[model samples]
Target: MGTFTHGATEWDVACPRRPSRVAGLTMAGFRVRDLDPLRMVPHPAVTLLLEFGAGSTVLDCAAGRQERGSIVAGPGLGTGGAVRARGVNVECVQVRLSPVIARAVLGASPADLDGAAVPLGDLWGREASRLREQLGDVPSWQDRFALTEALLARRCAAGPPVDPEVAWAWHRIAVSRGLARVDGLAAEVGWSRKRLWSRFRSQLGLPPKSAVKLVRFDHAAHRLVAGEAAARVAADTGYADQSHLHRDVMAFTGATPVALAAEPFLAVDDLAWPGHGTPGRPHVPAGQRPVRGPESAQPPH
Candidate 1:
């Protein structure tokens, strides 16, 4: 567990690489403290935040839904857009899906990728909040992770099922194995790249390669914020060189690694956990701010 700042808010966080055991599932937990108003909403990712001592308002990007209350489960990027948690004192557990992971689980193709934000409730229906309770009540962290894995397995199977390629690519991206190169991955899966692309578009709404880059950038951003040695993280995450890392960081985060790492308004509690283990994770800047640049800054909205 650690703490970081985002704008005027100070966030306290604790995360486990994997949840404690519970009927053979993996779980992860997230907690946030203090509060900051948000300006811009992030891209697609799943966030599960519970209001224990306070409350806030959240926006749903996909479904165009908005709610203000003590929420237990956040919306999926599909429907759940940007959120502004005001005066928040809460515990959150985010179960995020990279494009690769999403494809793998859904059995869809790269061209099917949409990158739209959907809330978990839109997909999981009523059981969404119940899953959080299951994790919260678990006796041990190990059990918590175990249950989370189980839930993912169940949910992955239950949904309309996206392209398997998206999930596969997402998994590779999450583990830093490159974009899974749609053509190469397609051949491995016994399909032509064109066929895979068609399926990918039909299902997820984003191209396979594009999704891979986003997932990779997302991984890099969190690690950079968490204070990993830039060179080391760059190497491990498949950047061709330090310059490559810097380029992407600057493009996506609008800050040099050193600049981002040093910023007081950075918090990583809401970042994604690629694998089931914890320890060498990174932090993320909190609240919404402009994606700054040396030339000009696009203030977050």
Candidate 2:
């Protein structure tokens, strides 16, 4: 366990002693005594929030919809800044599943989420409640992580996988930090543009271009949190200009780069996930961090 403090927000965060045996599966446990209302930032993985504690977890979503307890959201859950999270004495085990494996582990297509949060029960039925109970009963964070991984491995083993080409495209985008020329990737994989786009969206939840923008924004947003200048981040991450970067940030988060720089939601990632910004194992070559910086701003977001 470690303490992650960003501005006035603090959380007792835990990381598994080792990465999960399952590929694309990573777990982080968080216990926040007084979780302030934090804005949701877009991320490129399917997020599973399994809450278990004496207090409650609340998500305030767009159109005044609210969801409590466990939630599963597809990639870019907060596009247009539609979600906010707050809770008291909230303890949860958060899992980030790679899109390639999300369908298998989630037992539902990421496309169904459409980037919005849904109650876990809607997908997992009573097992969601049972899992919540089991998590609360667990004595240690490591135990909870092990239990969670076992469930994920079982589901992933039994569930269907995304097409190899689609998975390949997603990984290419990810390791390139969303700067990959997705347009060319289709040809590289011997698929036409239309076929690739439809398949990627149906299985993974978003179109290739949208995925690229979201991934790029995720990388740039974290750099902003790291106190890098907007202009510098833009240049480094493949935006046409600082204004372009600003627009992408505002589009995804509804916040200017300046305001997002101070957000604790992103700051916690540094401590919780640490070395990598996202939940899965590091995808970048050692020298390419920001956890895989893109090669150039070509096909700029």
Per residue, candidate 1 scores C-alpha lDDT tens digits across 160-208 of: 5444443343343334434445456554444567876666555545555
The segments of candidate 1 whose C-alpha lies over 4 angstroms from its true place after superposition are 1-27, 37-54, 57-87, 98-120, 128-153, 157-176, 179-182, 201-205, 226-247, 254-256, 262-301
lDDT of 1 at 111: 33
What 10-residue stretch in candidate 1 is worst by lDDT? 281-290
Off by over 4 Å in 2: 278-301
What residue pairs are clashing in model 2?
A: none
TM-score of 2: 0.92
